[model samples]
Target: MMMQISIDPASNKHSLLNVMHRFIAAANNMDETIMVPSLLRDVPLEEQANNNNNNDDDDDVAETQVASNKQRDMYEHYLLLKSIKNDMEWGLLKREMSSGASFLEIAVKQEEEEQQQPSVKRDLAVEDNADLEHQFHYHLRGLFGVLSKLTLQADHLTNRYKREIGGGNFMR
Candidate 1:
């Protein structure tokens, strides 16, 4: 869609400058679709032609708000795909190695991490309706958290023992 935005360059320099800034920004971000409408909305044809605008500050504020919204949209889109891929992989891991310690351990760890972590958005899948694949994501986070802590504690103790003695080795 070709968005032909006509902003009056004859208006006060501030409005004109900001429009040029937004146009350049949209082009740099590959967000050309947002350029025409956003610029036009801030500088109406009547106000531009009258050469008497009262909302110069409002224009800057609106620009910042719009920029924030665009950034948030990009972030959400990225996370949605990432979460889906992670859950799918966890599901496959669970299905292929049900009886193995490694698989069970991983599943449990993933569940814990999900519980403890605070993210920008919660998993889109609801618990009640989630399939085996999504469910495994939770379980896997938990298993990983518990194992990581245990591993760290074990290493700490081993280090302490080694420091106390000349030659100390621990494995069990």
Candidate 2:
């Protein structure tokens, strides 16, 4: 006999666990949908146009030049999404800080900044546990929103890839 688990749709929809699950599902779907990852190479994401728009022509030109130099292919995006999902499931691996500053130097700088902001220190000290809890929840909500957006992006990429190869009946 096999065991099955059921989730309460109403309550689970807004939960963090659900958001993470949705992102994982979307990533998996995208991975399966894109048969030839090479086909996605050099294909710009639909959202890239929105990001590239700038009022100033000079700034736009400079940004376009920089963006063109550093633009990643859709295959890279797929890999990145998979890597992020893996990291989220199994906590991020610890790596040495890339910045040239030593840990002690960073600590000293933080101490100096704290010393220069007595009022900020006092405000932090005054914050109660409930306030801290509220802050945590606030950030958690933001994380959920980000995860949802990433999930949508992964789905969009999958559809785009299908359309490119004339594989699936993709709408929009």
Best-matching candidate per TM-score: 2
lDDT (CA) for every model shown? 0.39, 0.67
Any idea what lDDT model 2 has? 0.67
Q: Could you say which candidate leads in lDDT? A: 2
After superposition, which runs of candidate 1 have C-alpha atoms over 4 Å from their true positions? 1-130, 167-172
Off by over 4 Å in 2: 1-11, 47-70, 94-130, 167-172
Across 109-168, the per-residue lDDT of candidate 1 in tens digits comes to 878877776352255434445687767778766655533332332232222223323322
Candidate 1 lDDT (Cα, whole model)? 0.39
RMSD of each: 26.2, 10.7
- TM-scores for every candidate against the unseen true structure: 0.22, 0.57
Residue-by-residue lDDT tens digits, candidate 2, 1-172: 9999887763578888888889999888988887777666665543346543522454343333334435676677777777777777765432213346676777788799999998978877787553888888899989987787678667766755765577432223
